[model samples]
Target: MTVRIGIDGRVLTDRYHGIGRVTHELVRAMAGTPGVELVVFTGEQSASRRFDLNLMAMLPGVEVVPVALNAVDVRQLWRWRPLLRGAMVDVMVFPYHLGAAPLLGRPAVALVHDCILETDPRFAPSPQVGFAYRIMTALVARTATIATVSRASAREVERFYGRRVHPDHVIGNGVDRLRDDPAAARRLESEYGLEPGYVLHVGAQRPHKNVAVLVEAIAEVPDARLVLVGSADERFPDEVAPAIERYGVADRVTRLPFVPEELLGTLYARAALLAYPSLVEGFGLPVLEAMVSRTPVIASDVPVLREVGGSAALYVAPRCARAWAAAITRLLADDDLRDGLVAAGAAHASHFTWGAAAARLVSACHSLAGTYLAEAAR
Candidate 1:
């Protein structure tokens, strides 16, 4: 039997961040899957940063439904049920946390990427936001079939919400193979003044990201240059600039707020190592991205990162600047160690692909639809 699945595509109307990328890739792959038809409900396109929803709509067995509501629009909390029923979908998938209200008697799947807002106060920024997250989490936990990106994240969800995510429902994230471009590498060298073998960090400068510790580590490596590629969060304390100044390494560090994917791939290919000092994460996607680019990685000795990087990355204590510095220096000085890590990392990253993730999601949808239909017939 065909499983007609409905998904919240509002994430596609904005810049493609982690969740947006997951939703976009999964739907794109599911469109080609046999016996599956997708009804993607999207909001009006963003004027400044819109992802092309038409591309997915044009694919076989896929349809796009435009709504007046955005992803974060509070109205969706109550309004989504009727629209979902009207679409006559066998199952509904909420790619993010916000829009998954109880679907009356309908079966729904809620993708819980992480419970950072509930676990980390720094991420919540305010008490009201934290409280709202608790309510939303509780509601979704009771109503929807829970899914997450990693086993580590599933444990976290169980810890906080008392909801268990079965092993089969733990749909992990994936990375694409990035090709190296010599011309783009040269452009980065000339235009951005980024030298080859520089230590690279790619993530938003959030409080939990531990950017200050990375800056401190760079300071200890007198000859090492650093490239930080992500936007700075104003809500949290500004640590990157202050640390760069305090360590007197401003001249050695290049900060780019954003870069096109082509340049980002080149940066990843040209860097000596990718340094990820995040204290916590849902999946640690950058670890896989770097590995696919054949770049060595030095990440925090955190569970989620360990799950993603496996033995392919060199792990360091998240808060230890000296440990990070030593790891960076050792990796740079040892060619054999770097080459071994690159080979292992590439092999490890190959196991994770969007096609595999999409297959898992399609299976989950089929299971939900089959169960619901059997119950209805009874």
Candidate 2:
């Protein structure tokens, strides 16, 4: 029997971020599965913005359905029940926690990327958002089969929501190897004033990202330059700007609010090393991406990063500027050490592939669908 899987593709309608990337890749990967059909529900596009899901929509066994309302709008919640019921799918997958509240008594899967908003309230920009996060997570805990991107995240979810995640449902993330482009390299250098071997950081300037300490560490290594490729949240205090000003290293840093995926691959391919000092994470995706690009990495000694980096990455305290500086300086000066890490990292990153992740997720969904069908017949 074919298992019809309904996916909440609302993330695709917004700006493409980590969660959206995961959904896109997984859907693409599952497109060729033997007995699964994908029905993706997307938000309506406005005159100002349009989402491109052409790749997935063109795939066999995949159907894209556009609802009348935008998923990000609160009005969509009131219409979710009827829309979901009307799909007549065997299983529904909410890629994130927020929209699964209406799926109670249905065979549903909710992917909880992290519990940062609940674990660290400061991560939430406002009290309203924080409260909403708490309520949605609690609702989903009762409504869906919860899954997470890493064992660390599964632990966090269980700790915060008291919901046990099946070991098989801890579906992790994957990365593809980045190709080296010489022409693009030259273009990036000219456009962004980028140096070939500068340190690279590729995430938002959130407080937990610990980018301020990275800035301070860059100050300690005068010859080293840094590229920050993510946007800053104005809702929080500008920690990175103050750190740059204090250290007088404004000239050594290049901050790009955003970059296309192709350029990001080139940046990863050309960087001397990747610095990820995030205090916590659901999964350290940048570490895996950097390793796949054959770049050595320096990440925090946090458990999730350690799980991702293994023996391939250099570990440093998340908050200590001095330690980060020492690690950076040491890694830069030692060519042998960098080469060794590059080799080890490539091998380590190869173990994570989108095919494997998609297989595990499909197996879980199939089981859920079969169980629900049997129960209904009884």
Candidate 3:
């Protein structure tokens, strides 16, 4: 039997961030696969952004339907159900865990990246933000079968809802489909300010990423600068900038924002080490991305990250600034150790491929369809 899936494609644009990247990458992969009819419900295409829409358009029978949703049009939001309901889809798949309300009459599965912005009241945006998140969480918690990137996130979801029921599973995220081309590195790095011998860190300066420890470490290792390749957080720039000044290492630490993902490998390849001391993650994607780039990684010895990094990365206490500095210095001074980690990281990264991830998702969807069919039969 054919399973018709109406996927919410609101995030498919040139302005693709992490969530958008995940949504676009997965849909791109899934559309090409054999047995399913994927009717994509998306926002209007932006002429400005660079995306693989031609690849999406070329797929055998996948349909892309644009949904222009606004605050005023509440009922039209779940346009997939109304538009494709007559098609009688076995299930609807929401990649970002939004639009679950439209799937109420039909069996739907929500790919929940994490419940961090919702479960942690402190990180919750505002009253409006908090309320909206609460509603989304409630929808996922009560109705949809959830799919999470990491076991830690799944456990968090389970605990918050006070459920013995395993509402979510650990499918995990995959990295770029692009092969490791030796020549591509040179071509990619030509434009960037290459820090050939720096300790690299790439991510947003969110409170949870524990970047200040790295700043402190810059004072200890005057020889190497910390290359932060993501945007700075305005709230803590005073706190962060002073640490850079206090350490007398303002020259040693550089912060770059919103870089192209492809050039990331060039940055990683040149790094003496990649430092990721994040306090939280649904899954440490940057670490995995770094691993794929064959960059030696020193990350916090936290559960979710350790699980993602396996034995590939050198792990340390996230809160200990001294420990982070020591790890950076060790990796910097020792080429043999760096080579060992690079070999291990490359091997660890090889275990996660887009094909394998897509297969797991296919299995889960088949399972959901089977359950839904049984209920309909009764």
Strongest candidate by lDDT: 1
Q: Put down candidate 2 lDDT per residue, 1-378, tens digits, no spaces.
A: 899898888777435467877888788889969999999987656421223587678998999888776544566556776776787778888887675655334688989998777767788888898998788789778878999999999999889889999999999998888767887798788988887899999987888888999899999997899999887887888898899999999999889987766677789988999999999988879999999999999999998999889999999989999999999999999999999999999999999998999899899999999999899999
Q: Which stretches of candidate 3 lie over 4 Å from their true place?
A: 14-16, 45-50, 70-80, 86-88, 118-120, 164-168, 177-190, 232-242
**What would the TM-score be for candidate 3 when compared with the true structure?**
0.87
The global C-alpha lDDT for each of the candidates, from Candidate 1 onward, is 0.87, 0.86, 0.72
Ranking by TM-score: 1, 2, 3
Which lDDT tens digits does candidate 3 get at residues 127-193?
A: 6766777676765667777878777778777776653334335677888633444554665446554
Question: Between which residue pairs do clashes occur in model 2?
Answer: none
Question: Considering only N, C-alpha and C atoms within 3 Å, which residue pairs clash in candidate 1?
Answer: none
Candidate 2 TM-score, C-alpha based: 0.95
Pick by TM-score: 1 or 3, better one: 1
Model 1, position 49, has a per-residue lDDT of 46
Ranking 2 against 3 by lDDT, winner: 2
| Minimal lDDT window, size 10, model 3 | 161-170
